[model samples]
Target: MANPSLKACFDRKKFVVAPGIFDMISAKVADGMGFDCLYVTGFGTVASGLGLPDAGIATYTDMISRIGRFAQMSRTPVIADADTGYGGLLNVRHTVMGYEAAGVSGIQLEDQEVPKKCGHTPGRRVIPAEEMVLKIKVAAEARRDPNFLIVARTDARTGLGLEEAIRRGRMYGEAGADIVFIESPESEAEMVAIGKAITDKPLLANNVEGGRTPILSKARLEEIGYGIAIYPAVGFLAAAAALERAYSHLKTAGDSNGLPASESYGFGRICELMGFPEVWDFERRWAQPAAKE
Candidate 1:
């Protein structure tokens, strides 16, 4: 079973912080940082893992295999991104089963057209309300564990505005989504208004860097009635942007002196993740400690 500590965090009135991680190293870092939960970000997975855009490019197995590592490393529960359920209603059923088998505690599916792009990006499309409702219904029914959360996300705010987005969100909620995420609201007013509109159930707010939505603080989101705020690409964006500058400096000046120096992860840190100490301990029953040369 997934971590119950995560459920406690969810039950609280305060907003939950789900840091997005694309790989095992990031997942370990997030767990070491003591995050309550881990998010397997579609955007981060597409960019960091595959070096591709989140235009519905990744496959179900590809994503699940990646998140399975995170679930193993982090004691925290994982909420995976199942973009548009990888297809229609039947596809949603398969997606749910696969993610659940992968040991994910929750999955967030979007109501977007096939080949769906990132929520923050332009040129996105959505499926009909009825179609998405069916997807949500199938996904909720397919889950083996009743505690496994099914979040129905709507990308209608970009095309149909907040009114239609809220309408679809409610429809999905009725279809048996454990939570609702109306993605990419434009302003603070939209965020607050969406929160107001969906008062019955927990609402999820996206906090993607350089995205369309305003970067409202978690404090503001909780006040607006949002139960969770997912910062899907914060780490990836920060790492990419910072590394680009550092690499540029190194190429141009033959030195990375201007780059901010983070503590070197070095051998010991690497060995810990690889369980080198445990391996050596298993080999040595009563061996003396190594002496300094």
Candidate 2:
């Protein structure tokens, strides 16, 4: 079962940090590491699942399938990125229902138009403020659980400007969005301004490492009045680096001997993580003995 609603955490005015995860194993690892929440990143999903960039190529069905697995793998609340809500207001409603049924505690809806790129990527465009507001309303109404959070994201900071992004964020908040995310603020001053401009609602900061935004610690984010800090590429980048190193060693050495022992999990430990021991115990307890000769 999933953990308690993220609303409780938000209500306390405590800053929440969610590490972005792309797959079931990453979800399990993040949950095991005691993260209170997980952000199912669309960017990571596209790169890992399709080997493509976040260019709005992933379909609604693709997102739903991955999110369902994330919801099942994570023991804590899952905040999924519902890119462009996959379409207009009606599609937003359907997206909300699908994510809710998948047990996600929060769904982030962005204002980018169809074929949206990653927030940090260039050449992105956003829908008009009025249109996005309607989508937010539809998303809010579609959720069966009132505590299920609707995070309204605006990529206007890059296309229009920070002021326009703030305007869209405020408009979406007024339309009943639970959280407002101003994607890709280029400076700490911009981040502070966003926190100040959208005071009526909780703000979410995207801490995409090596991206446009500066990666701030959770404490610094709280000081800036942001409610949530999401590290969307931390695990993915780390995993890629590790894989590159491992493969390079294997190719050069013709074996894994050159790799550091501390870098890998033991065979027994890997089995334990995969629940092999539990499977064996279940078989021993429930299976009948084989017929004797």
Candidate 3:
């Protein structure tokens, strides 16, 4: 049976803390970690693999194929970031259907215009409320599964003010979005205000490291009425820092003699983690008798 929580991911029924899984290795690691859900973060996926910023550079084809891979390989349910639904109404429909078919439990579609900037960064602007409302409606209608979620986000808090952002959140909830995400609330007070104002549906909090929002504990986020918090930058940030340190050491030392073995994954362990044991077993089972010498 499909995971019940995929359908039950509304009304703040359960709080979820989803770590961002950017690639197959991260996905495999997190899939085994007992997390109830995982987030396919756009920023990490673009930056970690493509060495590019998350600035609308990746197309839907670029993203959805990877999103499908994440979904296929992960044991945990996936909530993917679908920036601006790729385009207008028809695009919204296509994005929604595609994400659901690709096997994500939910998709977050933001209200920012195309060539959309990251939510925490500057110079972000939103579409008209009516326009995004239509997008939300189309997304909600596009999914074949009634349980599949439309996570409606408004980047109005960045360039626009918090009040406008909250208003848009409310508007989105009324438009049939399963969850309301008011992106980049800078202060706890603003977060409280969002919780207070948008009472009809569950709320989502974007917990980006070194980004605009304050990082709150799961208890505090639940206290503030957030049903889900996605830490989209955590995997990539830690991975990037580790990579820089390891590379810097190797360049300075001329060899890897000083780099700690503990710092990097053991090759054998990695092969085991990535299912090489299964391959080995298949090879053994299929092997022919050694030739006479």
**Per-candidate TM-score against the hidden true structure:** 0.90, 0.97, 0.95
lDDT of 1 by residue, 1-293 (tens): 55656656767765688998887777777777877778899888878788898898898867878877777767888999999888877888998998887788889999888898989889878888999988888997898887688889999989888899999999999999878999999999988888888887889988887789898887888898898888878878776777687678789989756555552345688789767899899779778889999
Which residue pairs does candidate 2 place in steric collision?
Answer: none
Task: For candidate 2, give the lDDT of residue 153.
Answer: 92
Sorted by lDDT, highest first, which candidate order results?
2, 3, 1
lDDT of 2: 0.88
Q: Please give the RMSD to the true structure for each candidate, in Å.
A: 3.5, 1.3, 1.6
Q: Which has the better TM-score: candidate 1, or candidate 2?
A: 2
lDDT per residue, candidate 3, 1-293, as tens digits? 12447556554377888899999999998899988789999988987668799898988898999999899888788989999999889988998888988888889999988898888888887889899999998887888887677789999887779889988999999999988999999999999999989877888899988888899999998897888888888887888888899999999998888799877988898999899999999999999998999
- Report the number of the highest-lDDT candidate: 2
Tens digits of per-residue lDDT, candidate 2, 21-113, equal: 997767877888876689999999889988998999998997898898889767789999999999978889999999999889899999898
Better of 1 and 3 by TM-score: 3
Worst 10-residue lDDT window, candidate 3: 1-10
lDDT of 1: 0.84
Work out how many backbone clashes candidate 1 has.
0
Ranking by TM-score: 2, 3, 1
Reference-based lDDT, residue 35, model 3: 84
